[model samples]
Target: MKLIFLGPPGAGKGTIASRISKDLNIPHISTGDLFRKAIKNQTELGKKVQQIIESGDLVPDALTVALVKERLNNPDVENGYILDGFPRTIKQADSLESFSKIDNVINFVISDEQVIQRLSGRRMCKNCGEGYHIENMKPQKEGICDKCGEELIIRPDDTPEAIKNRLAVYYESTAPLIDYYKEKGLLLDIDGAQEVGKVAEATSKAISK
Candidate 1:
């Protein structure tokens, strides 16, 4: 089933999206992953995105839309895909509606304080890049990676201010998609503060409708 997950940063949208995509056999496409690949390849779009990313500003809609369109047109997405990001603005959402039929819009609702705690505690292994949520998904040993012995460090983007800014942008830019999807009878708000497995179950139940 095609799906779009909407939520602020640290709201567990990615976690839920991954679960839904895996359990339902749908591709999980995320804009952040696309941009990271672009930056790694140092493509023209990557250079542009890297600049904006380093400046700690939102990637403009035009670039984001182009990137998203490229991803949506991929062969793997032909059957169905879980969109974890993109359509962060009215224009983009309107644009997507032109060609896409959103089966469901899963909105994960979480408080800002919880988001901060979730994000601030996040750390990743520099060697293996394995992610660990300090509290929710802790490493086997304190300040150490489970897979690699390297110490886990938080990326610069995971700062409290950046996380808060991302939430602000989500509320201002992406939250409206809630109404847009609701009008289409495709919006489902899921409580993100719950356990991951519970969240996944609730999401599946909602989308089954």
Candidate 2:
């Protein structure tokens, strides 16, 4: 199953996709991870990506498409794969269609308030980069990392204002792909506001059919 998981930031697409990847025996390919790997390996494309990222600019569609194309050519993807964060725009989606046929696009639907609440409550360990949540996954001690005994800090991007801004950007850029895939009869909407287990169950059921 060639799957694309789509959602606003904090909608838990990554979490659900990781679970589904293991259950379905497919690799979960995130574009962010691809970029990081490329940069770490110091490939030519990686050099360009590093420069673009250092300048605080979004990578061009052509460059991103090239990266996805290279990844899809790997032998492991011959069976199937879950794409987590590529094709964020119609142009990118079009580019994807040129090289691969996506079986379905799972759209995780949640409201802006829910997104803000979920993201703003998240905390990360200063030392080990472990994650915690204020309401959902609290540590043994307040504001402390259970694993490393370090202080937990809210990422700057996890601030309420930053989350709202990210949602706005998501709506502006990636939301249209919902309709794009829906018109092709390949979009599945899942209620992401539900508990994580419930949401995962719903997603599995949706894709299984």
Best-performing candidate as measured by TM-score: 2
What is the TM-score (0 to 1) of candidate 2?
0.98
Predictions in order: lDDT: 0.86, 0.94
Best by lDDT: 2
TM-scores for the candidates: 0.86, 0.98
Residues 1-209, candidate 1: write the lDDT tens digits.
77888888888888888888888887898988989988999988889999999999979888887777777888888778998887788898877877677777888998999889988999999999999987888898988998869999998879987887888878898888889889888888999999889999998998887
Enumerate residue pairs that collide in model 2: none
